[model samples]
Target: MSVTIEILSGLGAKGPAAIVVEAQGKRLLLDAGGALHPDDTITWANNLDVDAVLISHDHIDHIGGVAELAENVPLYCTPLVAKALPHNRPWHPLPERGTLEVEGITVTTGQAGHSLGGVWLHLAVGNGVLYSGDACFESSVFPFDTPPKAAIALLDASYGSYDQPQAYCVQAISERLDQPLAFPVPETGRALEMALWLAKEADRRQLTLAIDPVIRDNLAALLALPATLRRPGLDHSIRSLLARQNACPPTLQLMCDRSDTPEQWPDHHLLHTGYLTPDRRAELAAGQISWQRWNVHLRASHLVALADQLGATQVVPLFTPFSDNALSAWHGLLGERLCTAQRLYAPSRLVTRSSLGSFACPQ
Candidate 1:
C-alpha cells in the first residue's frame, strides 16, 4: 500500500489549513480554510480537486472556504458545525463520535475539545492517518476524545512550544480584570467558558457584566447537544449564566469577536484572549490593547502528550512558525518523530480491520 500526504497550506506559519491525503487512488481534502483576517485571500481552493472534503469544525479558517469549492464535491461535518456552512450548501452528516467510510476509506470523528461540534478526523489508510483540527485538552466545557493510533499525525501546533498551564493563564487574566474591560472572543469557541468565568468574577468584585447575545445563543445551542458532547458537571453553571440578565453600563463585557480597535470602546479597554491577527499584533505592540491566552488550543506539553497518545511515528505540527529557532525547539521535543515536509510518503504496510477498533470514541 502506498499513501501520499500533501500540505497545500497551513505549513510554517499561523494561517489557513488545507491538506490533501491520497491512498488507494483516492484523494481526501482534510480542510478547506479561508483567510483568518478580512483583508487576506486564499489561493489553495483555486482549481482544487478531491474525492471528498471533510471539515473538522466551523471556524472560519477551517470551513470558511467551502463556498469556493465546486458545488458537486461531497462535503461532511457534524450537524452543529453545518450551521456555519454557506446558506443552502449541501453536506453529508459526519458523526460526532463514530466512524464512516468516505471514498472507500474508513474515517472516524471525535470531539476535538476546542469548540462545539469540532472533531478530529482519523482516516484508516496505510497505518492510519490522523488530523487534529485546532484541538485542545483543557477546554472547560468541551471534551477531547482519545483517537486511534496512526503512523502520520497532522497535529495542531497553533501555540508552538509554549507550555503554560491553563491555571496560570486564568490567573494572569484575572489580575487584569480590575479595570473596566471588553474581551472579544470566538462565540462558539471560548466565549461560553469565559462568560461563565467572567460572570463569577464580576459577582466577586461587585462589578456588572454583559455577554453578547450571539454568544448566549450559542450557549443555548450547546446545551441542546447530547450530554456526552460536553465536559461533565457544567450544565448547571451554563444554565445559571444563561438565566442571568446583562447589566446596563457593565464594567466587563464578553462580546463576539470582530475587527475591534481600541477606539471602538472608549469606556472599556480591549483585552484579547485568543489568536492575534496581524492588525491586533500591531495594536499589542503599540500598547493599545492586551492579550492573554485562554487555552483553546494545545500547549507544548499537551501537544507532546497527544502525539504520544496517538502513537504517531511521523508528526507534522500545523499552523505555527517554523523559524530556525522554532525548528530547533521542536527538535528537542519531538526528536525523530518530527516531520516538517510539505509532501510525505508513508511506509508501505497493510493495516487490518481489527487494528481499527481503537477508532471508536469512548462512551
Candidate 2:
C-alpha cells in the first residue's frame, strides 16, 4: 500500500478526533484525542503506535490524549496550541503554510478558523491528504486562509447539513437583547468568536460589554499571539471592549460558569449560547433564558462544496456520525467522491508531484 488511513476514533460525538496515517514508512497520528463513551471517557488513542502527533487545536476532544503520549514522541501544532498544551513533551511549533519534512513525508499547516490557534494539515504522501480538525468557514472574527487542495480530505461534519449561517445566529441572539445579555460559552474555540461579535454588537448599539475573567484572559492570549494569526482591528476591538467594561451601561456579559442562572437573573436578558443539548434546552424551557445554537463546524453544503473546491477525490466525514439524510445530501454533491469512515482507506496510488498553493478567504 502506498498510503493507509485508519479512523481510530473521532467518527461521532462519542468518539475522539484521532486518525492514523501511515505513509513513507512513518505512522503519524492526526490528533491524540480521547473518546467520550456513554459511561466513561475511553482512551482509544492508547492503542495506536505512532511516530508523531499532530494537534489540530487545543480543544479537549482534539488534544485530550496528548499527555498520555510518550515523552520521546514529537508533537507538532501551531504555536498557540503548542504553548497551550499542559504537557511538557517535545512540542514542535509548526509554521503556518511552511512545509516540514518528517521521515520523507511532507506536511504543511493552514489556518483552520475554528479556534484561537487551530490549523488544518495538508499531508503529501503518495497523493495529498488534508485533515481538517474542527473547522469553521463562516467566522467573521477569525482569519481563515484559503482551503488547500488535496486528493483525500478528512473533514469536520459536526453539524451535518445544518446550514444556519453565523450571521443569522448572531442576529437571532442580538434581537432578544433589550437589556443586559449574558452568554455562557466554552472557554475557547467559538467563545472567542462570540465575544468578538458581542463586542462589535456592543459598539454598534453603544453599550458596555463585560467579559468574565476566563474570556478576558483568552482575549489577552489571542492578542499576544503573532499578528499573522489575527485579522486586523480584532485586537483593537477587544481592547475597546475591555475599556468599556469599567463603565456601567447596557452590557453583554461573558460568564464562564453556569452559575449565572437565567431563572434567577430575570432582570437581565440571558442569551446562553452553546451546543443545544437536552439539558440546555431544558434550562431554556424552565426559564426565560433564550438559547442560540452557534455552529463552529462546517454545514453539509459547505462541507461538500469545500471538498469539490479542494479537488478531493475521496472525502471522510468527522465530528458527528452521518445520517442517511446527511449521506444523501453529500452523495448529491460528491457522488462517488464522498466516502464515510466504515473501514480503512488504503490507496495503492503512487506519489504525484505537488504544486503548493494557498487558499484566500472570502472578504
TM-score attained by model 1: 0.96
Give all TM-scores, in the order shown: 0.96, 0.87
Candidate 2 residue-wise lDDT, 124-198, digit = tens: 765678899888777755666655567888988887767777778877877876677777776767777777777
Model 1 worst lDDT window (10 residues): 354-363
Which candidate should be chosen as best, given TM-score against the real structure?
1
Compute the lDDT of residue 75 as modeled in candidate 1: 97
Off by over 4 Å in 1: 348-363
After TM-score superposition, the amount by which residue 359's alpha carbon in candidate 1 deviates from its true location, in angstroms, is 13
Q: For candidate 1, write residues 1-363 as lDDT tens digits.
A: 689999999999988899999988899999989899889999998888899999999899998899999888999999989999999999999999899999989898888989988999998888878899999888888888888878889999999999888889999999998899999998899998898899889989999999999999999999999998887898998899899999989999999988788999999999999888888999999999999998889888788887887888899999999999999999999999999999989854645433322222221
Clashes of each: 0, 3
